[model samples]
Target: MLEGDERTGAGPKGALFCPSELRIARGERPSMIGTLDLLGRPAILIDQNGFVAAVNDNASKLFDDDLSVKGRRLFAADAQSRLRLDRLITQVRFLSGKPGRSTLQTVVTRSQRRPIVIDAIVQDWESAGDPLLPDMGALLILTDLNEIPRVSQSSVMEIFGLTPAQARLASLLVEGKSLEEIAFYMNISSGTARNHLKAVFLRTGTRRQAELVSLLSRLL
Candidate 1:
């Protein structure tokens, strides 16, 4: 949540675009820091100046020996990934609006066995409509190979507004299952499975199975 003093620092010109929720002083505490820790996901918040504002416990452990992130520059990671993070941060800072939100998929070598694939989402703290609080910065939500990603049937249905049958079909499609195989597993006829796929496509606004797969992959 960016608000208060942070917004004033941007001066009047920048304040014009300040989100409505940030216009008034509510003295809200930074709640996301605690929430991230509870979720046990590695996430960090950095100011536009590229300094780490806060880090969750998981992030501290993930980069335990490699880099000390809090209050330091994000470049402490590695040469290649540092460059990628630098660009991501710059992109968010310059864009500074809902349209400025973006995601970058990059790999970081934190071990000798294999590199960790990181999906970094850089977005402004605009949901609460405040960018003026002290140390209010954009978020860098990182998910790596070590994390177990489970997308439940209900989650897909709620996210895409799909019915239970449609959600099951879409999740199967994301797993690269064939239409016939899906029908067999669900104990339905191939035609019924195809019909569910059609409904999934319409609900997700995707014409092809590949497009539907891509959409669900991102959401999950």
Candidate 2:
């Protein structure tokens, strides 16, 4: 139920405001800000420069603060948060005016002392024709201490046309072992190992081991 709009302002690039869907937001009309607060997921609105404009109730509770975060540089809250946000921002920026989505995992400090892990999704916002808030930028949704979903071996095999053995080989490849190590562990010959790996690459349309690893790892 979260919503926001980008406005031409003296603030960050993708700054968002509550839309009409959330009634609890402090505005003359109903706004989505209230719904954002109710979501267990940590939601944040950022400006173009990647500064924190608004954070939902969950975020406030998690950080144990009700103080306004508006206009604060995203990274300013914590060094680690800053670094993570910077990377997300960089990815968003790289899309060059196209809306994009990306995910990041980072460690953050709770109550300015306790460390916690956060998984976040960064998405670009498209302006729906309003001139006042025209340059809408991005929305960041975060989950605390959760594992990112990964594709199972079966699913990966089905999607990439890998044989059962090749799929198992791909899984091992994602674990960072060398081909020889993988062969030894899987009780297969080196030649068979190379053959399985080659088939994995062809089925996955990858040309390099690192690329294959990255692609397969993200499936999960």
Candidate 3:
């Protein structure tokens, strides 16, 4: 959810393609696009016009035969949902400098198993403010809310040579838990949790919580 407006549902939507001239005209740079392509999650780059700029390999595989984003627009396969998605894009675009979020839901049918419902998160991309890089447009991230089960606590302990307490703290942090929440969950004091986190950071060579999360994401 965002400040002004936030909505959630099944899948994605938007314009078909970027005009040849508009491809590199505004938004993220080539390097940024390349970095997005490397992510394990499904990611799509869209211009301010809501045109699909680039799609990652995971997104291609996630949607499979049902959808294609290469040069086509990113949208729901169904018409009604497609219109909703268009409105979502408009809302997000209107927010501009401030990031807003909307989610759409869609079920991916399998050969024999039950359909898997996935949420596509559409949000404005915050710029890095690098003098050399131009601001890119918002990014669409596709997540399967059902996809659970992550790297185990023991796994993190083994990877980082952390103690049981440090491993527990690390696992919670990776799950986006704050230090206060971690302390409550572990029945420990905030100072204890902070000390454990400091140890975790030293062992993992990360200076911040975000960096630790990113490092763990790559490792996992």
Considering every candidate listed, which one attains the maximal lDDT? 1
lDDT of 2 by residue, 117-179 (tens): 545444444433333323334455554543333347898879988888998888877767799
Q: Could you tell me which 10 consecutive residues in candidate 1 have the lowest summed lDDT?
A: 15-24
114-163, model 1: which lDDT tens digit per residue? 45555555555565455443344466666556554445789898888988
* Candidate 3 residue-wise lDDT, 1-220, digit = tens: 0011112212332222223322433343345545755755666666666666555555545553334443445645555545656765675466544445555554544443344454545444454353332343456666654454255788888888999999888878877788999999999999999899899999999999999888886655
Q: What is the TM-score of each candidate against the true structure?
A: 0.47, 0.40, 0.44
TM-score-best of 1 and 2: 1
Error of 2 at 64 (Å): 5.0
Candidate 3: list runs displaced more than 4 Å: 1-29, 36-39, 97-127, 130-135, 146-155, 159-220
User: Model 1, stretches more than 4 Å misplaced?
Assistant: 1-29, 33-42, 47-51, 57-78, 83-133, 136-138, 143-152, 155-163, 175-192, 202-206, 214-220
For candidate 2, give the lDDT of residue 69: 38
- Candidate 1 achieves a global lDDT of 0.61
